[model samples]
Target: MNALQLSGLITAVATAGIVVIGLPLAWLLARRSFPGDVVFETLILLPLVLPPSVVGYYLLIALGDAGPLTSAGVHLLFTWQGAALASTVVGLPLMVKSAKAAIASVDPALENAARVCGSGEWEVFSRITLPLAQRGIAAGTVLGAARAFGEFGATLMVAGSIPGRTQTMPLAIYDAVQAGRYGDAHSLVLLTSVLAFFSLLAVARLEQAGATTPAHGAPAGGV
Candidate 1:
């Protein structure tokens, strides 16, 4: 149960980070065309295709006592923070992908019109673009949260199974299974399935809403 609480905390933190990092990035990817943009995007999306253990392994090297982060006195290995970091890495791509699609669905003419009406870039984004893109942003966050909740390999590599401290739901379930505690595993599995079902449902609804978003201003005058 403590591990489950930790998983909830980690999921919340990691998903929040995903939103903070993903929102601007999504906008950039959807609207910009800079040199090496494709490379940047590919890097962001790489974790989606990469093995979870592989990501965890690198995170270990980067967060280990002898690694750069530890060398700089930022110890995270075998801690809840380390687990959250790993979860963030795995979940970030989902958030960015959804956010990008959502932001892209917004009509450019609305932004241009707002700018022409004396709205600063930031103001236009905050008032018009962000509001219009809210559905996608929210969907991406839910997906990120779901991914973080189920993170196992990367969390294991970064934080290990430290009982009530760093061990999350997935890690706890693994431990129960390895200990031949089938009953415990079965209960955990049921809980996990319930959570996953709701999360997936949210993703589907949000994605559909985002995908079907009409052009900004359609309700008013049609962009």
Candidate 2:
């Protein structure tokens, strides 16, 4: 595939992976309050407020060939995977925060009722809480994916602007501008903006639909 296509694929995969992992972690954190819970939440949400380039720099230090992950024989720098890593790090906080909010919005009493009905912990969560929170989780996942797709600074710092290799849409646009390829840059920018806009629109529609859907006969606001 072309560089743009490859980058898009990598971003999507990485974003999906992060959301999949972060959502469950968010659920755990939201559902169970423990010592240092607030601290854990802050750490999970750290990337949201940090500079993207800073996050990429740290990832490079941790996952580069000569970094701490060297022993694992994984090389992330200047590769599409590196871009994916950067995207994941940058998008993780959004995913976790949205997911945590969604999970938290779920009514604990519903879960408790499920438990009293002899449902196992897994059953209660999967059947009651998960369905109730699916809308939020889906919305969060979409937001995280969009964030990853738009990431520029971090992906550039970690993955470099290697065309047809590590160059994502954002990086491609930047490179085009640097080389004075105004037409190319404009096209890329327009494309990215359109994609992002549609994504947000889709998310809004999903949220509205979710809001209107009956919560399986549960009390209003139970979700």
Candidate 3:
């Protein structure tokens, strides 16, 4: 596939998985504090702070041919799935952090009220907490999707920059530059930039929309 098609597919696939895993993880962090919470949160946020190369190196070891997963015969090197997995790792923290803040801002009293009104734990969360925090969660999801689109270093290390299968937008740009195809590189850069710019704009808009909500009040219909 060309860069445009490959990028879209990679972003869509990785983002879908990230949201599925991220939302509930975010909720867990927001609503409860378990043993080792800080430690787990720290691990999640490490990719944000650590050098991309460092993260890539670890992933390479974990998933490479000589890696433990390979020992179990689960090889992912030089594959689109590996690329998506790498992107998912980097994007997951943004989703979790953003969604956690959003969910935490929801009115605790509203949740209590829901419980008092015979809503089960799951029902209270599904009907009350999730809806109330959805704006922020949506924004976070966009941000995470954007992060996946920009995956390069770690993805390159783990997935390799194969032209059709593993070459995501950022990897394509890198390849263009390395091959001295300046025009192609420029085009790819512009394409990725435009996409990223709009995604970030959506994130900002979502955050702004979420800001209009009252921290202490329930939504209009019911708690």
lDDT tens string, model 1, 1-223? 4977999999988988888898889999999999999999999999999999999999999998789988899999998989999999999999899889878988899899999999998999999999888888888899888998999998988899999999898888999999999998999899999999999898788767645556544365422
Tens digit per residue, CA lDDT, model 3, 1-223: 9867877888888899889998989888889999999898889878887777888899988997688899998888778888888888889889999999989988889999999999999999999998888887898889889998898888888888888888888888888888899999998889888988999888877777666656655367632
TM-score between candidate 2 and the true structure: 0.91
RMSD of each: 2.6, 2.8, 2.5
How big is the positional error of residue 21 in model 1, measured in Å on the Cα after superposition?
Answer: 0.8
How should the candidates be ordered by lDDT, best one leading? 1, 3, 2
Q: How do all models score by TM-score?
A: 0.93, 0.91, 0.92
- Full candidate order by TM-score, most accurate first: 1, 3, 2
Clashes of 3: 0
Best by TM-score: 1
Residue pairs with backbone atoms closer than 3 Å in model 1 (clashes) = none
Q: State the local distance difference test value for candidate 3.
A: 0.86
Local distance difference test, each candidate = 0.89, 0.83, 0.86
Separate clash counts for every candidate: 0, 0, 0
